[model samples]
Target: MGSISDETVEENADAPTYVPSLPVPNVQELVKEDPLQVPDRYVRDQDDILQVNDMSWLSSEIPIIDLSLLSKGDKEELNKLDLACKEWGFFQVVNHGVAKKVLQDMKDATTEFFELPLEEKNKYAMPPDDIQGYGHAYVVSEDQTLDWSDALILVVYPAQYRKLKFWPSTPKGYKDIIEAYSKGVKDVGVELLRSFSTIMGMDQDALLGLHEELVQALRVNYYPECSRPDQVLGISPHSDTSTITILMQEHDKHGLQIKHNGGWVPVKPIPDALVVNVGDVIEILSNGKYKSIEHRAVTNESKERISYASFLVPRDDVEIEPLDHLVDSQSTQKMYKKVVYGEYLRSSMKRRMEGKAHTQMAKVET
Candidate 1:
């Protein structure tokens, strides 16, 4: 453990390009105070509580992709990747080349971070006018329903974009572990993008060329156990707005569920495998060939859950739209309108999470 100094946080209080989220109560401490009587604000209605009532859809599992096979140019693996994107829009990645020790180190550091005293953790709290820090995100108003979690949101890639002032200075090597894990995950993301381009019958650079740079950010969610778990959601159902989201479940606990075929299916965690899912950007660039799945986190009745989601996006200024290959003259219509990544991101940050609502902003209705 290391001591936290306020100097760095004070110096960068007004970080540029940040979208502000309204301050929210810290769920972890609140639960410690009383796990039973959840505040009215955290209590959600039945519809919100159970987005999909039917669970018969759990019979099918999301696709699992082997990176080693894909790297070998295996035709069968390629076909599987293509089908996974177009159909399920979600998959688990194995043999991804990220070392087990690195992953475990990150998980341990994060667990230690959340275990710190509230006041110590508060040293990295999200500023009143910026969302990139340790706190709830997308809380745009006081009346909005709250999720039963606390999150640390940070931009990790494009190294220049990182605001280290918001990063934890404790647990000794927290920063280094996060950097190593992020790099490994980023390599996977770029490779997946290449696979997607190849699937579309274009060269490897086809999709990668759409943006000037690949941006990566991370959101570490800490879902505390709730006594009235049925009444509170860990996170609201929403599709990621990035090009792709790579998720790692740190605690080996089940909380992630994706909406599938009009019902919700719990995502079973495969040890050492990371979950990857298409996002709105891919859906738009694919001209709707690839769909972004709607998913949410459910609270556990007894155990806590922690997950890290790495969001890979394009450069903020790029104009994102259906690719030329997907929107050929023979095509019936272009399914999505063009959007500037920065504008789309700002819009998403300024509002609360709504199921697939951010993705809808880019749709070109027929």
Candidate 2:
């Protein structure tokens, strides 16, 4: 774990000393008030159904890779990455060369942003129509009663137009710092995609070519200390919708969990390491060669948690379907349609807002 510095101090001196105690709304009341109506799907018993301790069977072999030691051009490292992608769908990367200071700065800035007073933070609050912002859960209704968390979701892509209008003005240097970090993460993502291409037995540039104009976003999530950590979840079980997600976690706080084999396993944090995972788009493009694993976040009774997830999505105009080379007369290659990335993203957002399970892609014409 990385050493804690003074930057971890709470940004808002006048902010609530603790998460406010709000009454948990009933399911019917939640549905009536929330536009997302997420709580409607889950049974709202006071029982701690979300808690699970039988994680012994969970995969303990999360791959820890050292990119600097591996030959970037070597076929062996690429092969190893590919195998990890197919089997684990998640891995920890070290020595990937994004400065440790930059990562820490981003984390510090995020914690400070979320610490802002409710009124000040609300200035950049997500619009009722947009499901991204400084709130507990945008897609769900306030009455739905989420466990406990606040997040800042930033959309930085197309370098032109964004489909969803969710951007927050922050402290003086916040934007510049975050944008630089985003660009750095994007470059790393490109490198990983190139490695994936090699593993798929395609030209190194093939995947990069297809993603020349990828749309990317950063989700800065903060899960505050919960009064009833065992009774609820920080984030419900779900799979990511992007091609891939690279996450930087706070030291000492253990909130991230992943479903592997059959149980949930805590992903212990490693200082300066980036947690990389496959997403739904990669599963489709790889024709199921790579799976998108289900994961969730859990709250702690005492310690607050923070995480930064950089999602690499395909450009709105990119055609999403299995690669031609992966298909053959003997292979069942026609599983999904050639839909535009933008359409797929919109559909995913709607499903998420509804608090439904992630939707699988179906074969259909654009």
Candidate 3:
């Protein structure tokens, strides 16, 4: 086990004060009333939620990377990847070699599972005070306004930690499809982690070595069609807690939005492409060179959006921080304090649940 660094703080072992109450209502089970009416509970506290319907932003440039070339030792591709990581902080990967059939199967299975009755779906309901199974994530209070989306979360790595109880047995091939999809994602993520290291002027295995016990959690988010898409959020604006996240959205509706330049911009959906983003841990590990963008999901009046996010996280007890080589080689100062992955995650959860700034909670004083 790693010791907590002096620069970090973990009061009461950094456990969250607010524990979530279980058996919460699944948002997808609720009725999506009318095209112009939004439930008061789903209304966001913030007034601005991009009430306009504009596709002009899609015409603007966005990073859509081709991973097949990057894996073949193309220097230009490496440079592009580095730029996208440092500047865009988000990109879409295509031609990644994962079969289109596998992707589709996973999406089909997710849809079928969420489409089940409330009782059948709640069979995998999350335990009280935890956010690991079916239901809306981070529902800590009775009055806490909930997101307009329902999600199924599964931990699918490090065989020992697998909770078979929550694993679904429907759709015949659900388990196999997920296994294959996860393997493909892991292959891509491992390559990207190595690429990230190469771009940082460190040994290729420097960062990869930290993944001896890689933990991957999958969240299948179903953003049901909302009556008033202009007024409510499918998901709130927040950064992910993983080191990296691989996301796949249903091809038809594009609802993912990222904060940029001074406004929220949409990430257009490209068929068979996987969206990747730098997460908070990577920002700390890269010594603030890479960024974790704040992004959210918007609902649509007529279309529903389903997305799968594969989150790659470190073991809770593992030490997560910037590499010695990164700070030394670049002559850059360590801009954040090193903390155990578990503690930092708890702090982040509390901040997100209470509507606070979770991303910058660990910035070190320069």
Which numbered prediction scores highest in lDDT against the true structure? 1
Candidate 3 overall Cα lDDT vs. reference?
Answer: 0.75
Clashing pairs in 3: none
Q: lDDT score, residue 3, model 2?
A: 18
- Candidate 2 lDDT over residue span 37-77, tens digit each: 34432423443344445473453578877666443666676
Ranked by lDDT, top first: 1, 3, 2
Across 150-172, the per-residue lDDT of candidate 3 in tens digits comes to: 88877777645555546666656
> How much does candidate 2 score in TM-score?
0.80
Residue pairs in candidate 2 whose N, alpha carbon or C atoms collide under 3 angstroms: 34-141, 337-363
On residues 292-339, what C-alpha lDDT tens digit does candidate 1 reach at each position? 999999998898889999999888889999987688777448999999
- The count of backbone overlaps in candidate 2 is 2
Q: Each candidate: what lDDT?
A: 0.86, 0.66, 0.75
What CA RMSD would you report for each candidate? Answer: 2.9, 8.7, 7.2
Global CA lDDT computed for model 2: 0.66
Please give the clash total of every predicted structure, in order: 0, 2, 0
Q: Mark the regions of model 2 whose C-alpha exceeds 4 Å error after superposition.
A: 1-53, 56-60, 69-71, 136-147, 162-170, 331-333, 353-356, 363-366
Error of 2 at 303 (Å): 1.3
